[model samples]
Target: MAEKYRVGIIGRTDRGNYGHGLDSVWREIDRAQVIAVADDDERGRWSARSRTGAERAYSDYREMLEQEQLDIVAVAPRWMNEHKDMMLAAAEHGCHIYTEKPFCRDLTEADEIVAACEMRHLKLAIAHQTRWTPTLDVVKREISKGLIGRVLEIRGRGKEDARRGGGEDLWVLGSHVLDLMRVFGGDPQTCYATVLENGEPVTGSHVREGNEGIGPLAGDAINAMYTLPEGATGYFGSHRGTAGDPSRFGIQVFGSEGVVEFLTGHLAPCHVLRDSSWSPGRSRKEWVPISSNGVGKPETLPRTGLHGGNVLAVNDLIDCIGNPEQQPKCSMYDARWTVEMIAGVFESHRTGGPVTLPLKQRENPLTLL
Candidate 1:
């Protein structure tokens, strides 16, 4: 904490605090103090200023970035539409960033966000906090140790919510599921997609208008599969069903010896369990707590050290800047596959054919993009 990093937070009290835990995370870092606050809504700005008590208040995020000599900027906005612009400004000033999830709304913007940060030699860490949970850590360790035996196959899905309706589940929640897949499968060699909204394909003629914004993005579900470099096949489904709609968000990993079943997100009503050939009493297995620590030593910060390990992502970004020699465990480039994973599903639906990734062309078709 010797080298304190000044920060400016582009935060909103609404939008459920960006769903990344930054509202409270800043309190844990003695070395990190928010020096400014900004939001388009005046009330949101007032709330941010009162919460962080920054010396300066702004209604425009770009203006704040121009004035504040910040070491880091936390983009904690509710929607993904503004992330590209917000982040690029931060990178232009040579500041690192901690952005909210789904990274960006589409592949076109996703690439821009990554390139903007990389061009400035800055680190970009998405708010996929489950990557740091204690339960998830155990799962990763077990997978590395072959606890699940040969690591045969993997699968996961999302429950319903307000954000559930859009075919963008892949963008919203699929990022988390796909990221976990990458953790186990390494880089994917090829990808295949199948998409449905309420179990139907979306076409250009059948425009979808959702996201609380007018557009053709409100598809209902996204389902896709990928072939990992190690020959492991992985699958992910982001269905916008209902919050309390008897939905389960978790991973089912099959292996020769055992299996690791992971529940997605740190959200409430979580039911994480594990099963294997090794049997038990009446139930094949017992309920296991889900958690995640640090995977690799991506930075000089103590393994699970920064942000007191609570906001693992924010801490990881700090460690990335503090220890430039070490690469972050997650990066924007590492996340493109996630976009590819979702887009492939849409492509499959749009073209009435199975979509492929490592796409050969690597082009985006979303006209709005």
Candidate 2:
């Protein structure tokens, strides 16, 4: 019989909690076993232990890490503030990690997490579940096959709800879109952005503490442009109270010959429009459905939603652990790039001009304002 990988889960009761069922997904993986769980809240700790079928529970995650011989640790909290410490602790214990998104508050934290994992040769995967979806594979394959000829531009938007619109939306939801932009548009080279609050340019006075422990935030409307390699340009925008009926929150890839559109879910619908004119009315083109198998084919994956996506991600993480050469599709480095993109928007807005990638300013740009 193969050795079962021992897993530990970390969560906080009402604070972020076990994000998107990260703890429960381990129950579905046959090759892994949940050995312990940690949550500061006594009630939440026991609940997590029962939920994950963990043998033990701890109030402090650091103690759990020190006691358990864990092979993998799921830093399940959705909050960004807990991510850096949890990840570093896991790395120090020689355990691989799978954590929720909005990687960290700033590039400095991200760099520290990256360094710690690198030092330990630990594999860390972020919960950008959409990247693990089979639909993305089809999208990539179609783009490569000239279904969308010579990709020219990529655009993404966030769920601009009443509360989490603009800068907040960019950090919380736009991270997913930015990851997709990099997948299709290549590495971003430079960015120029504008941030506004009730029609006025955001200034230092506008900065305030954001939700989810995201440091200093400003702006209720944001528009950003990025330059990618090979002449591909990227754009991300969000405005408070401007979300449409169907929600204008997804990605669109425009090519010389056509365009592809996809929403932000593991099984989100994907469509391709083939038209040289790039306008459906002018060219009489219709958008065609794309599936995991291929363009217009049926999806073969039995599972769906976050559970399904986490299954795929965990399986890949296990494989990467053994292989050492492979990396999770949504690896830690990809998460870092997503953070950089989010930071670049504010950084560019602060400077009133374009800012180069691998941003020199490691702190939150709102603070510099």
Candidate 3:
């Protein structure tokens, strides 16, 4: 029989409610038991304990970590301000971590968390649930088989909704597509970006505190372009107070012979076009939707929605932990690089040219503004 892994959950209900069901989702994952929970707020702590069926709860996460003897801890807070400290605490206790995305406030924080987890030889999985989508594997396999020919370029977008657009949308939504781009074209070599406010270039005054502790942010509209390793171009854009008819928010891979488009969020569908000209309207080929199992009829997904994706991510964590040779699908290295891509956009805007990869400025670029 497999050993039951003791799990603890951490949250701050005042900031984004237990990281979108991350705490309770562990109940659906096998070999994991929620034994403890912690929250700064008295009410939130009780709520988290009740939701995760934890045997005990605390008002301080550090206290919970020091007491629990947990094998795993769900650092389920959406705000980036607390991520680094919480991750460090979990690492110190030799607990594997599954945390909310946007990784951390800056690359510096990301480095510390990554190093701590590495020193402990523990698995650190970011909550980029799209990496766990089963259909993504199918899309990757198809790409490997050259169904779309030689990959040439990629385009991605954020939701560009009424409430949040531009830099905020980029950090919140663009991070997902950036990760997808990495899945397709590895890490970007350089980034050149143009950021604007009211159709004019953003100035230092434009910088302001971002939502949920993401850090200083600027730009109400942005267009960032990148050069990938193999001469492939990448584009990510978002505009404030403006949206398209269909609300384009996903990644499209353009190849020499065809194209592939993948929706942004977890478990979103993907499709392939075999037209040589890569024109959907003019080409004679049809767009075929690919799924986890087949082209049209998708296989029965294990769980539904974000909870389902969380379960898959937890499974990957467990699998990686059990198998010494296997690595977590969304490892700490991957999370740090994802933050780099986001920060590189601002660095490019500041320098008036392309900013190279493995950024020199470890802090949030917006802060420099």
TM-score for all predictions?
A: 0.83, 0.97, 0.96
Tell me the spans in candidate 1 whose CA falls farther than 4 Å from its real position.
12-19, 161-166, 212-215, 239-246, 265-310, 352-356, 360-369
Worst 10 residues of 2 by lDDT: 295-304
The superposed Cα distance between candidate 3 and the true structure at residue 17, in angstroms, equals 1.7
lDDT per model vs. reference: 0.65, 0.91, 0.86
Between candidates 1 and 2, the TM-score winner = 2
TM-score of candidate 2 against the unseen true structure: 0.97
Weakest 10 consecutive residues of candidate 1 by summed lDDT: 293-302
| Tens digits of lDDT, candidate 1, 216-248 | 464666666777766678887665645444555
Candidate 2, pairs of clashing residues: none
Write model 3 residue lDDT over 117-196, tens digit each, in one string: 88888998888888989888888888878888888999998888877799999888888889999998888999999899
By lDDT: ranked, best first: 2, 3, 1
| Candidate 3 Cα misplacement greater than 4 A, ranges | 296-298
